[model samples]
Target chain A: MKGLSKDRLWAIIVLLPSIILLGIFVYGFIGRTVYVSLTDWGNDPAQAMALHPVIKFVGLDNYKELFSGFLQSRFRQELVSTIFFTVFFILGCLGAGLGLALILDRNPKGEGLWRTIFLFPMSLSFIVTGTIWRWMLQPQGGLNMAPTVLGGQPATFGWMSSTDAIWKFDWNKLPLLTASVVGLVLAWVAFGAFRRAERTRAVVAAICAALLLGWALFVGPNLHLLAAPELHGFNLALIGIIIAAVWQMSGYTMALYLAGLRGIPEELREAAQVDGATQTQMYRSVIFPLLAPISLSAMIILGHISLKIFDLVYAMSGPDNTFTSVPALNMYLTSFRQNQFAMGAAIGTILLILVAFVIVPYLSSQFRTQEGHA
Target chain B: MTARAERLTPGRIGMYLILLLAALFFLVPVYLLFATALKSPDAINLATSWHWPAQLNWGSFRDAWDKIGGNLGNSLFLAVVSTLFAAVLGSLNGYALSKWKFRGANTLFALMLFGMFIPYQAVLIPLFQFIKSLGLYGSIWGLILAHMVYGLPITTLIFRNFYADVPDALVEAATIDGAGFWQIYQQVIFPISIPGFVVVIIWEFTQVWNEFLFAATLTNTNSQPVTYALSQLAGGQAVSWNLPMAGAILAALPTLLVYILLGRYFVRGLLAGSVKG
Candidate 1:
């Protein structure tokens, strides 16, 4: 018979505020969101009720409209873009991050300098990241100046302009040199070169920061003037968002991989080397197998973040920027921007359903492993 | 690991090579910020092969400070309050879920786990509606509420794993002595859990301080957090790049200082017993 002491009650009382807030603001809203998604509220509160909104007993109709591309008309397209963004984003961030991790793990001479350089971009908000990247992608800004300097004509084409020319090009065979390709290809090509080139490394390294600043300057208003091409008229804005996100988040991935790399058993590597396993084999078979768990974890986290990415896209494209849409952004526009609260809530619930599908199984597996030990 | 000791093998060189290349990929953007911040605006605008800033413009810091509302007061306030709230409540929630075997405890814990999965953007609309409904919209407190909701799940998860490592014998002893929950928690439990507490505090503080989405969407004024304020500096007007750079540096300084000064704690706190898996 443990008695509830006065302080115990007080402690519980003190936690009441937080608990109440979480229960209502978090769990409650989620429930409401699910409920609202079932209704056909449309854009007007009047149609909410007049359009059969008795809490609208339409079971799965909203979900149908969402998938069928009927209700919002833009839902299906947005979903496709969201999925693409997620795939590219996850891979890009992980690749870049791992590459960064490998580089920084060498215990470089100026370790702090490199660490600070990698992490500083993370300090800026998504808005800033979006703004900076927008500037760097501009035809007249720092980004194009390189081409102009290299005896090439200055780029007047706005990569983010419209999607018109895209559909005409073979989607599968489209040149990797697309505007969205800027961050990924450039990071891989230019940055990759500087990474491996030793003596010139120091020289290029000295100039690397200037290049980043050049990109940052173009991230904001410069992005707004981007229009559509006459053909596909697809917004390349999504590409910029993905690029910026990968650039910013790769550092995080690198840090995680670095930690994982450090945890590898040295004795195994030594044994492999003594047996004459080549560097490629050691990495491919041994090191890679060992890094799997960390890699998987990184992938999971990166995938989840990519799926839910909004800040970079929203800030760069804005509410009306309309280059592309992720699930979160779609949800935001439906609710706040378009006044279709019910539809937005529905989209949110769908996102939650997707998130739950991934998270619940992973969590349960983890819990089971823990319980096995217990 | 002993392979490196055996000889300066080609493999080791390759490893170093890989490490160097990876480092460059990660470090460029950060380096650029410093280079640009130090450069005069005129030089920055000039496309002359992107060299180091001709002369250091330390005044960019001053410009950033003024443009970003003259100080980082709003950011500091939101971060401090959110961090403290998350730490205290998270620890308490962890304690309740871990130690107090009340009815629905497991269910409540599982329910709270959803906080991590629901991205800030997903809840932005409903949350905004909810906050506006509560009449707390546009206030720092509103942003605090939003951050706290997400902060709890992670913080509690960390503390729960940590508290699970605490043997039940001490708690049982205190209970047998009629010392009740609070007494055992304060006298017997907390003092020994300093390491876990530090980890929770550090993680929560960084999460709150570095947070952007809620801070930006929930509040619209300079009275918002530094992340949002710094963001607005760039988005608001066609001001000098130096101004936003100042705000960027100022916004970044607090976490950077903590990382530098309390680095050991930051590092240890990061990888300690607070388990996510």
Candidate 2:
């Protein structure tokens, strides 16, 4: 270290500020936040008490309260909503984005104009998009009234206010439901692995499925509900917010897919065409499979956005609407508005874990793949 | 396949129609934003909610401006200052990491990249307390600092990748010319980084301009950015569709203009940002 050149020494000096700034402001703050989250900083420190609030190390009590406490059911509900929202949002963006990208890949006239128009919404702030969609999705008017102008009855659906959730059931049944779902996906994965003759991977997936199904059948815990049958399901109210998010993000997906589609060598498609494959068949058999990497990356990108969704939901549904409450929004209100810093941080930590669940794997795999290619 | 000719068959027409419909779907919200923003309060009545105003009303924009003008100024001030700071710092860091590679530079850059994915929510609690301790609790400068901290990751990544493309011989030549690290940056490195700077500026400015969580939490009414202000317009008890719509457009103007004028760069920035980031 002492033998380093003058320029190298100067480089170290020049880089010190960012190193210090990001280390403190970014990494240090995260560490500090996680530490604070473990403490009893402001369990009920509403208003004046927040300034000199009680701060104590309560360990993971906040987490326990959120996941198992009776009154903190909202957190669990929000967790479920986030999962559903992420799925729907990713699907919406991918489907619409792929469709748009496929169209643009044909190199039609006005391609530049259409591409720009398609991707422009990705530029606007979420608050603005949310505002526009709020007006568009109002219960009494907006999209509903378009029918009445044509001498038809206006739709009575409460786009963002509907409290009814689909597939709702007792909270006690949740473990069973989740285990079944996990079991099914594992079974599918196992079957694929078996067909491909990947013995170890197939056995691993089969074991996972067996464990999940065993839990569903015997070991799953029954959560005591605040209500006799606490139902958690797809909240119809979030549909509007989901639509707004998809609208804002689909263009981003479109650009990715369009680039990917263009990158596919024309010879591949030409060969398929020469083999007498129909256009749809060509896309289905050849093109779409080639776009798998694009889809994976898109899913990861959209998954994170959907998980940390705050502004869009806040702007569209406002603070008062709990039915459409996402984890980020709930975290905001919990920490800032309600003075439950510990609880809010717990929620934030959970969200971080959920996102990390997706992102950490994706990023590491991507890096590995890049390294392999190199 | 067949020859280069693409005959205008019914299928071609159908594709065009589908694209047109997608275009319409995308345009509806932007159209509604302008239409509602320009409509008078009376013209925003139920039956005419989707109608073009009987008369073009610029008054609503004025009204919205009067309410949020200060916040808009704060947003501009913070975004510009923060963006400038982030870009410069990012340029310096990027230059050092990509070119003057020392031991652990790649590791440090990887560590920094982790910051990009940290959910702001995870740090909001401590960041607020930290801001308070630093006496920046309710100030726009606080927001600037916060944005810089958050903006560093991507900005650094962008410039790092950009600078990586700079041939090492250029830097080596500058070294032979008796240039110091900063001197080499000024002459050899900075000139080629204009495009990188553009991408970072547009990316950070748009992000910080449109950011809501930090602004809402960190600032008071007097110092809040327009994102917070626009959100307040909607979240306020009285949902005045017209004025809020106007405020939304006003708040969105800078980013929207960036998109409209330099959209190609914006898209390019976004693409590069994600792939590399």
Candidate 3:
């Protein structure tokens, strides 16, 4: 036992540098960031935008300011836009990626050549992709002017400057009203699930709906999610960035889907064909469901990238372009540029939690799977 | 992979057409970049952005090379150095964790991997201060350290997963033959780590080379990597489209070329590592 323990100790010693370096750089830095977020460091406008010797413990004031207080209004708006961007980006990438995968999966002409062309963007950095797409989506000069080269009319539309969202409602001041609508949608979904006999999902959804409806109706119009009645559009600017991101990532998802497609044996498709399944019907009913795991994996990857998008937005719109500001960029500007170190840390903490939400469960399950395999 | 009908059916033809259109869609941006890179300043504007350049402006590449060449060199140096450092450390850590059968090693691994999930934003402030305190801030070496530090988790994860595939019997036999830790590593493990090394090299090389945020925050003008340098060219006030496009190509081509040359390992590297996600 002593010899075994000694060997273990030696092993630990051998790994000490990795453990220590990761400890300070990773874990220790996270700890320090959290601590800094609590302190009122670098918040003063008149003070030098550097580390403060006489920093005071502000205790979530920075978070409060960003969330509801009037100082960091742009931050809150940016956060909302990030949500919109991520949701739409994921959808766009999945659709295009899966579509491309399906096309490639048909064993088309010169398949390897086509596959390489599709996946080529996966090789370029976001900075390069962003530059290209920035030029591509330049409102006056980019794809809009393609009409000109063909002797067609020039595009009159603002491709990346349009501010109109596909859908907009004036519920900014009516917070309770928005809650009720959300509650009703949940209730409807729960009701449908109940009809479908998904008991657990129904129960959870019902309870959430009940809580949201109860709060909205009883508490009335006071529970606010926004600091002001700010207009949030799908920012035509984000389309350019989204186009760039999707162009870059669709290839990756396509590759994943191709791998998934290859893993599916040909016998299954033949069986489906024997069942008189039409091509569209076969894909919709048979092939699409089988690609769920690949879809989930692709969504996870795209979600993470969209959340941490800085390079694409930076290269496309530049830093001052608030039309496509996201949490990562906001964190950078607030801390390094604005000198609001604590608030920046707060944003970073929020981003960490956001990333963890996507990653932690995936990792936990991955570890479990590896353990099972071993 | 698909169940081909063994004939050019209308559906197959349609699929080919769709693919060709999609290929053209994907190629347009790269095409624009190259075409714009070739054009003189007056040849490219709102009306002409999509058209071919009037003349091949080889001078723009020269101009771009002159401006961003130094930073590109820095990027190549930092990426190679950091990838080497991180890979070696990760390889050692992986060997110990996989073969040493030590207590607390799994816990240490789990702890280290938690770093992989952390958004780099979370650590920027403290990391900046920490590097400054160490008197290495604003230096290329500081940028390298930052890359190595963040690169540790993914590299360690890859190496660990790779080493875990090795049979226990080999290590046990090595042990019984009086081989010590480093001795077995040198003789039994290091020789066979080429594939694993390739995976980590492709992974970390692309990551550190394309990495911008850490380099942007940690380094000064002399130390700024090519990724940031490319951004500077784009954001610079003068609308010198040709040079920035050329710089973007210059910054982008190394990894792109590496992908073309070692694409099999690169794709395997991507599919194998969910640690990034």
Best by lDDT: 2
lDDT of 3 by residue, B1-277 (tens): 3464568879777887888899888998888999999998778786688778878999888888998999989999999999999999888888878888664556567778878767899999999998898899989988899889888887888888888889989988997898888788899989999998998998899989998899889999998889898898988867678889988899899999888788877877777655532
Model 1 lDDT at residue B137: 86
Model 1 CA lDDT for position A273? 96
User: Per-residue CA lDDT of candidate 1, range B156-203, in tens?
Assistant: 777777787888777788878988767877898778777777777776
State which candidate, 1 or 2, has the greater DockQ. Answer: 2
Model 1 residue runs over 4 Å out of place are A1-20, A40-42, A45-65, A68-73, A100-124, A146-236, A270-279, B1-20, B35-60, B99-107, B167-180, B220-222, B262-277
Predictions ranked by lDDT, top down? 2, 3, 1
> Judged by TM-score, which candidate is best?
2
Residue A240 error, candidate 3, Å: 1.0
The CAPRI quality class of candidate 2 comes to medium
**Candidates 1 and 2, the one with greater lDDT:** 2
DockQ of every candidate structure = 0.26, 0.61, 0.63
Question: Cα lDDT for residue A181, model 1?
Answer: 45
lDDT tens digits, residues B32-135, model 2? 78888888877787667777777999999899999999999999999999999999999998898888878777667767876778788988988898888899
True lDDT of residue A323, candidate 2: 90
On residues A1-374, what C-alpha lDDT tens digit does candidate 2 reach at each position?
Answer: 33578888887897898888889876787787778779877775552155566578989888878766788778778888998999999999999999999888887887889988988888888988888898889888787787876789888889998999997767767767889999999999999999999999999999999999888877775544244566688899989888889889999999989888878998998899999999889989999999998899889888988899899988898886889998899999988888787778888888888888877787667555644422
